[model samples]
Target: MLTARFKLDPEDRVVSFHLEGHAGDAVKGENIICAAASAIAQTAIGSLQDIARIEPDYQAEDGLICCRVSYDGDDQDQLIQIASLMGSVRIGCMQLEDSYGSHYITCIDES
Candidate 1:
């Protein structure tokens, strides 16, 4: 099963996410769950760096991805954007977890 993990800051803000196993779940277009998970994760990472202008420590390889970003507490814009983006990550992950019922995917690390 695919595993989704979110690392959170002390205030419960998402600092990073780690996903594994989905990309290899099936042949192309065979697993909708894998595609949806990939989309949600990639969008979150791209939007954080490209749209929010927050550079994160990240790594990507076949069937694996991890990204972490530190937010500036003094920057209101960063806080707002990060909050929303991270919330999206949380929601997307939880929705998948709920809908798939841990057979296709599982959420971890208090996410």
Candidate 2:
């Protein structure tokens, strides 16, 4: 299964997200679950960098994606944008998990 972890701050804002493992729903190239997850994750990262103009720390490799956002505290606007984008990512991940329980799992951690 593909596991997605969202790390949040005390105020419930997402600080980072990590995705690992493969969705063995189908053979290698035919895994729709993996494709869906990748699309959502890549879009989230792209939006943060392209639209929000926040270059979050991130890494991606075979069956793995990890992204971290460090807020400036002073930039409320940027913070809001990042939160909104990350929220979308969380929602997408939850929906994917719901539809493909056997292939996907999502978890959220608040600190």
Candidate 3:
């Protein structure tokens, strides 16, 4: 199963997110669950770096993706944009989890 963990800051903003493991719902190349998760994650990362211009630390590999947004006190606009992008990712993952409960799990941690 795929495990997706979203870590939030005191203000309830997602500071980091980690997605690992495969859905195992189908063969490696034909898993729609995995494909949906991957697309959401990659799109969010691209938006954060390209549109938001926020240089979040990130790593992507087969069946694994980890990203942590660095907070800049002086850049509230950029931070908000990043938050929106991450929110979209979270929503997509949540929908996947709801539809494929047995193949995907989502956890949120607040700190």
Tens-digit lDDT string for candidate 2 (1-111): 888888888778888889887888788657887788788889999999998898889999998988999877788888899998887777888888888784356655556
TM-score comparison, 1 vs 3, better candidate: 3
How high a TM-score does candidate 2 get?
Answer: 0.90
Number of the top lDDT candidate: 3
Alpha carbon lDDT at 76, candidate 3: 78
Query: What lDDT tens digits, residue by residue, belong to model 1 across residues 1-111?
Result: 778888887888888888888634578557787778778878888898888888777787767777777777698887889878876876887898898778878888753
List ranges where model 3 is wrong by over 4 Å: none
- The C-alpha stretches of model 1 lying farther than 4 A from their native spots are 23-25
Measure candidate 1: CA RMSD.
2.2
**For model 3, where is the 10-residue window of minimal lDDT?**
102-111
Candidates 1 and 2 compared: the better one by lDDT is: 2
Q: How accurate is candidate 3 locally (lDDT)?
A: 0.84
| Winning model by TM-score | 3
Query: Per-prediction TM-score, please?
Result: 0.85, 0.90, 0.91
